[model samples]
Target chain A: MLLDKFQSMAGVRAELEAIGIVPFGAVTEKITSATEGVVNGHQVILAGTNNYLGMSFDTRCIASAQAAAETWGTGTTGSRMANGTFAEHIALEQELAQFYGVDQAIVFTTGYAATQGMCATLAGPGDVILLDADSHASIYAGAQLSGAEIIRFKHSDTNDLEKRLRRLGDRTGNTLIVVEGIYSMLGDVAPLKEIAELKRRYGGYLLVDEAHSMGVLGEHGRGAAEAAGVEDDVDFIAGTFSKSLGATGGFCVSRHALLEAIRFSVRSYIFTASATPGVIASVRTALKIITAEPQRRERLWENAQLLYTGLKQLGLAVGPSVSPVVAVTIEDRVEALQSWQKLLEAGVYVNLVVPPASPSEKSMLRCSVSAAHSPEQIDHIIAAFAAVNAARPVGIPVA
Target chain B: MPNYNIYVDYIYTVLRTIKQDVEFTENTDLVTELGLSSLQVMELIEHIEDHFDISISLNILPDINTVGDLARKLQELNG
Candidate 1:
């Protein structure tokens, strides 16, 4: 009975095995570049990875990481509260705050921890949290942990959100309204402009998780909040180094001075070991690159446009907008699974997202474009999808 | 405090909007009997919160199972 929950998972694994496909944990034999990798013996274009700026293989980042490894050794080996608070860690925190134009920033071991820690510590019992229904798992975990009265408004529906906020009435001041800059699954942006207006009318602190939008949106790549000209209205900004910075770490930055006091209260920040010197170094280098080169962001958007048009022209149901994350919805799970395998065999790798993981009931072949992907590579990715569509049964719908 | 029967009747009204055919009572299991998805459950909670004008802590969700259980919780909160 203790392991009964795993029975269903085991059954699902067995079903996939019978089909001779390992969709979830397909191993990458080697990464050739930010855009290409050898996956399951197939040389495939890496479309699923969230390496938006493609800093993963940047020579400057690599060199910086190497230098840091040489100077500070490999890892910090302890939590920041204990012995892991290295100079580079503090520097990264300072640089992150400066980048976001905030007074303070607290770095965490991972993006999940950063968002979750903030959500958990910012509000507690007797307080209310109004979050988007399609918020990331970290937000949900943190909200539940906070023991607050959690209310989920329909995803990106300002009317629904306003209705809930109105219901809160005098308790609006005690509410923390949480939303994401760009939703990961569908790549649709939050209506921050409208949400900020609502917050002004009602009263609540706003937190935006810019995990998918940090390096993908805005003039200076500050994310959706900046693009919408609502940076001042935003109370806290949580982001991850894993996506755009091309490293593994998370941070929460805020103009509010209370963030400093809240820093010591976050258990995740205190319990988890600090990021390695190498990760910190690479992220620092990546941040500088992001600031200096606006061309990367432009090229990324261009690639996204190309892919979006290509997929749309092929009659595939793509995401709501032309975003770095382009998801093709497939209502049939079997077709989605088979199409994913077919794409991999054709030298294109993407993420196969199903229910629960996907925001909706539909299965999605999620592809994330990086600035490093050449135009030719984008065409090839489109070609692979076209090929799969052509091979589908006559009665079945094309994904 | 609101009468527990009033809470139950109001819950039934909300549940019918989600599923018209299913018969619900105070003792009926909200999850197993009605087969309400997580999203549906949240929708039900939102409706209840709107009607009552009271914020319900999610920490109490695990302890709530039947219509009666929810009604009792609502009554306690209203009290």
Candidate 2:
């Protein structure tokens, strides 16, 4: 009976496979390099990976990760509060705080846990959480666990957010407004400037999850909050190392000195094993490289512009604006699936996203551009889209 | 007394934002006819609750199917 809820999913899977679209988890056979990979025995250009800065293959990062594994064993057998916190972990936290110019930084095993822990630890039952309707699953999960009254405003509609805040009346001061810097699915940056202004007027804590925008925005690559000159207004920032940092971990940094108290209170942080030595070392090295090599960010933007312009020229529908991620939106699921399969067959790979998970219930082929993508590869990806568009014209009406 | 026309107009306004050039009748199905997903419905509810100064429980959600159902329920709750 427990598995009965998921029984209908098998039918959905068969329908997707019937149209040659692989749902959920599709495996890449091998990764030959940072930007190139062999998927399903075919050498495919990776356009869907979130390796924005492309530091995964950097020599310093790789060497540091390898050395860390050798110095310390492969895994931390316990949680950070227990037997897991290493000097590298503490050092990385310190460096992150310095990078963000925040007072405290707490690292989590994964980005999801960081948000989950922050929401659960910070907001309680009587408090409120006003979030964007298109927020990522992790934020929603955290809000659910927070025991707080959850409210959602129209996506990117700051006016609607202000309406909700005004309606909160006396509860406005105790509310937490959650938004993402760059929404993972649509790749649109939040209107942080206006939202920060709202926070000032309404009196509430602002949390921005820069999971996709960190290392891709701002003069110093702080995030959208920094880019919009609202870094001081943002009360907390949660971000992931899996993206631009090219490793796997999450962090929450804040200006509030009391933020360090979360380490002892967050069950997600206290219970889960800390990130391995290798990931910590690699992320630390990547963070240093992010600050040192500003050109990587520039190159990433250039690549993003190239792909975005090319896709648009090919008459494909893309997300709001050009950033590291470019999502080609398709309203119909079957058409999206067919297009995804067609792109893969042409030696190109991108994420095939579907309803409920994707914002606004539309399907999308999400592609994230990397700084390391060569001009030829960018051209190749555009050409692949052109070919697929010419062959299958995704705008075909449903029968 | 609450103005019924105002509540109807408010519901219509929310539906129009989701889709313009569409008309909302009292018996119009929000989901099937208007093509609103569950998330959009929740957004509609939030808009109503905020402007009406009322809290709608999830228990009443199952009873709401059409625009009239929602409007009538809001009136009942307000009373």
Candidate 3:
């Protein structure tokens, strides 16, 4: 009886399978290269992963991770506040802080934990959180955990944000406004300049989640805040090592002298074990590569443009902006699945996204580009999409 | 910007921008009739906020069903 709520999920699963869209449990047989993988007996080009810099296969990163695994062993048995605080963990935190030119930084087990813990720890009860309507799920979870008075403003509408802030009157100072550097779904950049200006006028703290922006924006790869020339204006920045850094971890950096105070209050951080030594070591190496080789970022954008313009030329609808994330949208779920399966058959692999996960219930065949992808690989991806679009099932139109 | 008629015309224009094939009327349901996604509906709300200089709560989205409902809300906020 306690598990009866799962029936609704079962009904939804049945409906999706009947429509030929299975949105879960995809297993890749082997990763032969940075850009290609074997899935279901087919060698497919990997375009769905968030490995933006393609450093996952970098020899230096792998070498460092292998060395760390030998040196530090496998897992840390304790959390950061307890026995889990290793020297390398503290060193990585210091390195991230220095990279962002912030006074302090705290690394978490995952990016989701960093965002959720920071938001939950920073503000609570009487405090208000005026967040972008299109914010990621982690941010919303953070606000809920914080017990803050949550209010969502129109996405990217500075004027509306100001109006909501103004309505708070004396409570504005305690407000924490949260926004992302780049939205994960549509790959759109936030108006950090305008939002920063509004925070100035309203006297509220600003939190920018750079999960998808780090190593892809600004001269130093600091993310949208730096790209908008408002890095100094942002109060807190939460980011991840999984995307461009090609490792797995999350961190929050702040210029605030009191940022270390959150370490004691964050339940997620207090309860969870620290990242593995191998991951921390690999991420440190990846950070060095990100700084040393800006060409990877440039090539990433070129590939994005190549795929974006190619899909547009083929008359397929894509996301609003051009970034590493290129989402090809279809009208409904059935069409989305059919196109995705067709792309797989043509030796391409992309993410099949549907409602609840996708904004506005829009179904998307999401492709994430990487510097590791060759020009021919990019062409193959475009050609695969074209083939699927040309042979699309009858009566199902592109939205 | 000057009157309710202008607001109505402006809202109609924004609706058309979301979907070119749709015909706008007071009775047109935003979801079923216009086929606007939740994200597109948010876009519509943003355009409305920009034009009227008002902040509409996201919670009001479910209460609104048709073009006339949106118009009435806009008028209420304007007053």
lDDT of 2 by residue, A285-354 (tens): 9999999999999999999999999988877788879978898888788778887888888889899888
Strongest candidate by lDDT = 1
lDDT of candidate 1 over A261-357, digit per residue (tens) = 9999998999988999999999999999999999999999999999999998989999888999999999888888899999999999999998778
Error of 2 at A399 (Å): 17
**Residues B1-79, candidate 1, lDDT per residue (tens digit)?**
5678888989999999999988887899988899887777877887887787665666678989999999998888776
Which residue pairs collide, candidate 3? none
Selected candidate, larger TM-score, 1 vs 3 = 1
Q: Against the true structure, whose DockQ is highest?
A: 1
Candidate 3 chain A, which ten residues in sequence have the lowest lDDT sum?
Answer: A390-399
Candidate 2 chain A lowest-lDDT run of ten: A390-399
Question: A1-399, model 3: which lDDT tens digit per residue?
Answer: 999979989998898778655657667899987789986667899999889999899999999999999999898888999998989999998999999998899999999999999888898888888898888889988988888777789778787788888877888899999999988887889999999998888798999999999999898889999999999999999999889999888999999988899777888889999999999999999999999999999999999999888887887878888888898877788788878877887999899888777876678889999999999999999999888777755522556
On the 0 to 100 scale, the lDDT of residue A181 in model 1 is 98
For candidate 1, list the clashing residue pairs, or say none.
Answer: none
Off by over 4 Å in 1: A394-399, B1-23, B46-57, B75-79
Q: Chain B alone, TM-score of each model?
A: 0.93, 0.89, 0.86
- Residue range with the least summed lDDT across 10 consecutive positions in model 1 chain A: A390-399
iRMSD per model?
Answer: 2.8, 3.8, 3.8
Better of 2 and 3 by TM-score: 2
